[model samples]
Target: PLKVFNSEQIRNIGVGGHSGSGKTSLMETMLFAMGETTRIGATEQGNTISDYNEDEIERQVSINTSILHGEWKHTKLNMIDTPGFSDFYGDVVSGMRAADFMMIVVSAADGVQVGTERVRQMADRYHLPRFYVINKLDRENVDFDKVYHELRERFGKKLAIAQFPAESGPNFTTVIDVIKQKAYKYAHDKSGKVTEEAIPGNLQSQVNKIRNELVETVAESDDTLLETYFEAGELTEAQLLDGFKSAINRQMIVPVVGVSATANVGVHSLMDFIVEYMPDPTRRPAIEQDGATRKPSDSDPLSALVFKTVSEAHVGELSLVKVFSGILKTGDEVYNPGSSKSERIGQIFLLNGKNKKNIDQLHAGDIGALVKLKSTHTGNTLCQKGKEFELPPIEFPEPLISVAVVAKAKGDEDKIGAGLHTLHEEDPTFLVRYDGELKQTIASGQGELHLD
Candidate 1:
């Protein structure tokens, strides 16, 4: 959207999970449900909004993170869809750094995975509040309870079931939201249209049990809420809602939501929950560096962090940045603390995969792209001169595999060297260096797919 939103009206969510957990599909369903797209797109079809690149479409896997946006209930949601493979794990680190919170997706059929645990650890390290979305309920052998228990076993007992599929497999058309205590039956045509219904007769007891557990989870975090719950035997809807949000902000309640992205079920309710319960960008504390605290406020001194870089066909190099403080205006001069150089601010644009929406300015707590910076690269902080605050750089993981490389042709040595640097700039996890002992160039990464 071209309209500028304040920090209070923004939610920066980093979406991540296992490789086949249907993260891309989940992103597509959200965009469609938010009215940003005409219809849902499938991963197998290669037309999804998140996996738009040729390499990703050819392999039917996400290779890089795609920055996407959608307006839900007049609140701007800036989503970072990170790749699930460990090969491109650097993207997940950047996503966590840029997000105000994390949404960890898990496949209903697969349960927990290596990547799932990895992301949970990263979120804990960053102290970011997160929830789990159990996706692919329409797939065969999907068990929502099994996945829920697995998450509780690994994550914690504080993991509360927010929603669950009424029936799984090919007929998963309805999901019950524990908070709303209502059922949502969605259409099967990928239109994301749903009709509200009462709680099913057979599922009422289970829903009640889950709702009670949610109330208990929230009440445990506040003594006043606990006393009220004991005195009244049950909390009113308003009290429970406020307690739920407070518990979530304190990380005392970890909610699990069930969805079938392919069937376009339960996706809208998920967004509604986010708008109702999740904390806004203003809730997150500012990044403190150089004895300066950069809050997410338009009136504060300017500070922005470049977390990633990509080279578009006609756009040249685009630096994806998150404004941690103050407003970023076009044609302004900013200083790069990391590079110790002055860089001119150019045009700013909002992105949805390959598509770009031109905007002249970005408010604090918003993420956008700045075109053609001379001295700034990934992990650099841009701010007003003499009011310096260097944002902490994303700590990319160490490479797990290495290989020797050589030019295929005799005259292509310089070309190969230059190409590797460009690729390294795009992905810091992929490292290259000349081994003087072997007199050869060695390239390393998380795995063979990353090197290839």
Candidate 2:
């Protein structure tokens, strides 16, 4: 039986960071922990679920945003793994549109880099609630404390440590979860199995201090908790948990967790924190237009936005959409306000990287891919006829570099032009234009690598 998730049960999270920050590795560990995969996949080995593209595997980097889904603690999480390079930032923008929250991954050794700051700003632009995951804790010369302080100083005091390494480098096996007041030690075998243990005696004092700070910050989110704290000078674990979740949803507290993705240390704790604290899609504010707001509800009129289009060798073009208002089922007719054309919905699929699962329907706030749409492109709005509403299109940055493309074969002009058009459909950030004055076809993108 296929499990269907309601809007409130769905958590759409965008995972992003700078290149080599281990974003793909973290996702692979997550999928493994969730029982979605039998073993952890490595990016270096080109076997990661998210980096399935040939270009990405060959380059050992992600060039496009990949969507992966898993069930954690009875909650459905749609993880949007995005490219870290600025050259493919268009995919990042598209990923953000479909995500309800952002998980900013940072390398412990690298701290905050250019790509980290870019993703931070993108979270702000999208108004998505965000948290941080400091990855690569097992790397030599990595300073978790230094990176943690840097993130706090750069991002703001709102950034709070939710979990910290029990030890650094080769001994990095345990993480003390401040929120749950528990310690989890990962086996050295990288099997992702964690055993609960008491907080180490040496780290107890630090844990107490950090937990107090976390409770205080969470208490500030609600008046009742604040009053209780003032009276009792502390909060119970239950109260703190409730308050922390509220604070996280409102962006009042940005929790940070440390992990060694390759070693599988702290990955389970990180996934649990996400399932426990991250906001569900419905918790986000409603989408507004012309002083009107559209709440996520199956009873509301149908409204969805197409955020990505992928041209596959066998499937042609797949338009990935996020339902923001009502239920969308297979074989239903919908109208695209952007193209002003009516099209029948064909097969709907729930994406797990390149693997698609046939699903009968998707509720509001759920993301699914629609197959063989006639005229839909990225950022197009689809809805029931006469209930038309257009979402603001995703704003992609202007190309940073341009080059003239020439066809080597004499009769390959039309083929070149058609191929360029198809590529443009896949990536809106890449643009193609015919310069009449220069009599040359111009191709522009974020960088030379992107244009190539």
Which candidate number would show the highest TM-score if scored against the true structure? 2
- Whole-model lDDT, model 2: 0.90
Q: List the residue pairs that clash in candidate 1.
A: none
Query: Please, what is the TM-score per model?
Result: 0.97, 0.97
Off by over 4 Å in 1: none
Q: Write the per-residue lDDT of candidate 2 for residues 366-444, one digit (tens) a residue.
A: 9989999998899999988888878889999989999999999899999999999998998999999999999999999
User: Distance (Å) between predicted and true CA of 387, model 2?
Assistant: 1.5
What are the per-residue Cα lDDT tens digits for candidate 1 across 1-452? Answer: 47888888898999999999999999988898778788888889889988988889988889998899989999999999999988889889988888988899999888999999999999899988889999989998889999999999998888998888999999999989998899999998767789999999999999989899999888887999999999998899999999888787778888889998878888998998888888887778777876769888898999998999988877888999999998999998999988899998888999999889999888989999999999888899999998988888889999999999999999898999989998888888989999999999999998988898
lDDT of each: 0.90, 0.90
- In model 1, the Cα lDDT at residue 140 comes to 84
* lDDT (Cα, 0-100) at 389 in candidate 2: 79
